[model samples]
Target: MKKNLKPTITASFLAIAISAIACQNNSGKTAQTDSLKQDTSKFLTQPLISNIYTADPSAHVFEGKIYIYPSHDIEAGTPENDNGDHFDMRDYRILSMDSVNGKVTDHGVALDIKDIPWAGRQLWAPDAAYKNGTYYLYFPVKDKNDVFRIGVATSKTPAGPFKAEPQPIKGSFSIDPAVFTDDDGTSYMYFGGIWGGQLQRWKDGKYDANGSKTDSQKEDEPALTAKIAKLSNDMLSFAEPVKDVIILDKEGKPLLTKDHDRRFFEGAWMHKYNGKYYFTYSTGDTHFLASAVSDNPYGPFTYQGTFMEPVQGWTTHHSIIEVKGKWYIFYHDTQLSGKTHLRNVKVTELTHNADGTIGLIKPLKK
Candidate 1:
């Protein structure tokens, strides 16, 4: 869902900087100070592209090249709120690289809100899939009714000027659509996000405009879970009813609503390693990237642990992929603009343990 309440740049700092600049006569000094403020030297992995703001990176390997599908961010001047009105993204731009730290190419605008007949605004996080010589782009955006729905766009080439369907996939709601194709050629879409993502609004399979801001308020009740569904062969529609993805504890009980640190929040991602299905997600407000494991695509997954600690921003979203036998994670933070809504994507090496557990990754280099 990609909403952050914290402001990376504090008000006091802004005030002090403005006062200092006003008292100075040299415009050159002011320009130099602004440049220094945008310094990204402390980041463990530098941003993939700096020409524009991007976030919620969905990385994949298509035809031996790394392709990224991310939300194109802009300063829309909308006020921030719990409903995520400030993340006023209107388009998507694809990125590609030959290697982990290689030069990244931004393939201009792949799709825009105006191109989709049903889309309203806020083109959030998106994922890409390939099948039968065609590429599919899955995304979440608000419709004219202001309800978020999942939409699909198609392209013949990996880097696309994609053509979107006239309407969103039927029965699709909420946000963060991630599609994973298994070795058997079956693809499952994992989605749903609490809070601003609007997953909690669909408790009874209907959109409730005045839904709970968080998950089930009861400490003993099962937490609101992420949603999953099998994608039809055509990849334009769901093959079955959307189901809840359950995360269990060591004793095999469902993760309770009170378990804020480990419960599913948003940014659902699945990857296969060592014949096991790894389900990873963001713990939105708590700001951790956690994982669970299951033998089947539809999971009663057991909680593993947090793989990534909090970054410099309020919202964290990511994707994991394997390239040439090496695994890497693509994620975003507020290092570039020092604002929650404007983020930059980055990539770093990911390690899987011998026992099938993921190693904890500290986003900060130090």
Candidate 2:
């Protein structure tokens, strides 16, 4: 019969037990690792410029600079210049700027899902991070059939209205969300391509049964050969029985014995240069982008190669920023000779070497 706790729920449980005893006695501030080195020789090329918004692009490399956010869908048959028709879009938001030494700036709508409730109103891919002081945006909606899911929002600055996260991340079926924070601090999100599996908020958000994965479920996990997931550390939970599995269709092997595309290895991105771990995915039936390597970072990877070619009308999902020294990939393109099929977002110039390999990018067309 102990039911008398009111006073704002006992002062919210004594301010969360005095902030969990002051974060176990002071240690609460450490999340900007991955300095990014190694790869002493890789130097790709191809994107000196391309459509800044043609649709759904994503890239990260904060603080020192290299942002290239996208997904600012707000179409109306689309048309501001040479081509029109952007398909369906009304207000999703995420358009930061900054490219590098050459200089660039757009900074419009850094983050806006319009207060995600079930995100039933659109709000496609966003992806961002900075932690601690704030600046987090993870998005993806359209729940029902195409069953897309994934929702999160927060903002301390990065030009945003961010601030969501009450639900929307349950068991995950598919979306386009992405977030990765490694180098020990741990924080992951990496979503799936179309309609598949991947869900983890771990650390406290919960769910890392090998860190979420499902392209049919194998026997209940660890079989991949592609489609992806690797979440954990409470960035909302993930990682447990989920193991290796990252082959590319025909050339790398395993289309899962038959019935492909829709799932081959959707988006799946993660970085860590020299020490190892370099995922990067997307393959066949369209959408190119490719790679493989794994000192660990939860992988059995090894594939490697193929940095672009989702064709001129559209390509694969990609993101990777660097700044301060140079490296950019942010992808998504629908050609625009008159607005072909609605996907915009492009950036270019991404390298890699020291012994990692990933060259030839160049894009840059806005």
Candidate 3:
């Protein structure tokens, strides 16, 4: 009876061991299946940089590579020495990406506000362009007198060690400097914001020939009207009179009269596609990416409406560029830090409709 019981016990133990081994093998197979599923079903990701907060993405295609110039957002004051929101950013970082391998190379600080002799603080929205053989960078910074001024920096390469000009462009007030060159060997600079000012002209380093104030300037006019003009060969100043190219409403009327919906706040980007001028900007409250179009760079621009919506922050500065047959909208959001001022830059593929209008871009989280 004892021997029979011992044999039965051994058989029971072997059955339990076999069951445990089978379960382990099955669990491993299930995990492998899940891993493959996750690898296959992936979504489009954005916010190109995550380790640090970057704002005001200004993208440019240079020599078959995509270079992004963005403002670096860092913790300003310490907890012991609290100083409000502290949006105190002082340097610019240039990031380059050539493929979708999810690898971005940071070229380090391109420009520092402290490096400029005349500038004080707030190294804000910037733009870049390649002309003749030089790469030019345009930035807006407050001067020692506490006035916002536009400045230019030059570099032999896109990702620079840029050498800033001795001083800010004279007579240039307000912020957000957007430089555009047309197909006809023409260049233009668009600028101004707040307090009812949006002005531009040829980048010849000069103002209007008929003088700046054409009509009797009103103190109470809308502050968001964006303007454009031709640029000179050197792109140092204006070459033509500034024209108000503010977006037009659906009814073919200026946006200022009906509402400030499509008016420019800051960050004006110019892109020409298929013989049409694509003028894009950050609208009032810095929440929407609004655009307009016309046959000419300086319009009669019909407001095309908002292409990109607001993110988790207050500001939505951006740039539009075409790279290797792909159009991308480079913008910024606050999803990383949750604070409005600590924003990060992002990019997504932008598409245009058959009618030449831009399609609404859905922001992605990766």
**346: Cα error in model 3, Å:** 1.3
lDDT of 2 by residue, 114-219 (tens): 4565655445556777766777777766543334567666777665656778776555545566666777777766565522333321323343444433343444
Most accurate candidate by lDDT = 1
lDDT of 3 at 150: 83
Off by over 4 Å in 3: 1-44, 78-86, 195-223, 364-366
Q: What C-alpha lDDT, on a 0 to 100 scale, does residue 201 get in candidate 3?
A: 22
TM-score (C-alpha) between model 1 and the true structure: 0.89
From the highest lDDT down, the ranking of the candidates is 1, 3, 2
* Candidate 1 lowest-lDDT run of ten: 23-32
- TM-score for candidate 3, please give it: 0.76
What's model 3's lDDT at 217? 35
Off-target runs (Cα >4 Å) in candidate 2 are 1-67, 70-95, 98-109, 112-114, 120-138, 141-173, 177-254, 257-317, 320-327, 330-348, 351-366
What lDDT does each candidate get?
0.83, 0.49, 0.65
- Candidates 1 and 3 compared: the better one by lDDT is 1
Q: Tens digit of lDDT per residue, candidate 3, span 21-125? A: 211110122001111123212323334544346788888778877788887776665232111125556777777777532456666667877789899876777
Q: After superposition, how far is residue 66 of candidate 3 from its true place, in Å?
A: 0.5
lDDT of 3 at 135: 89
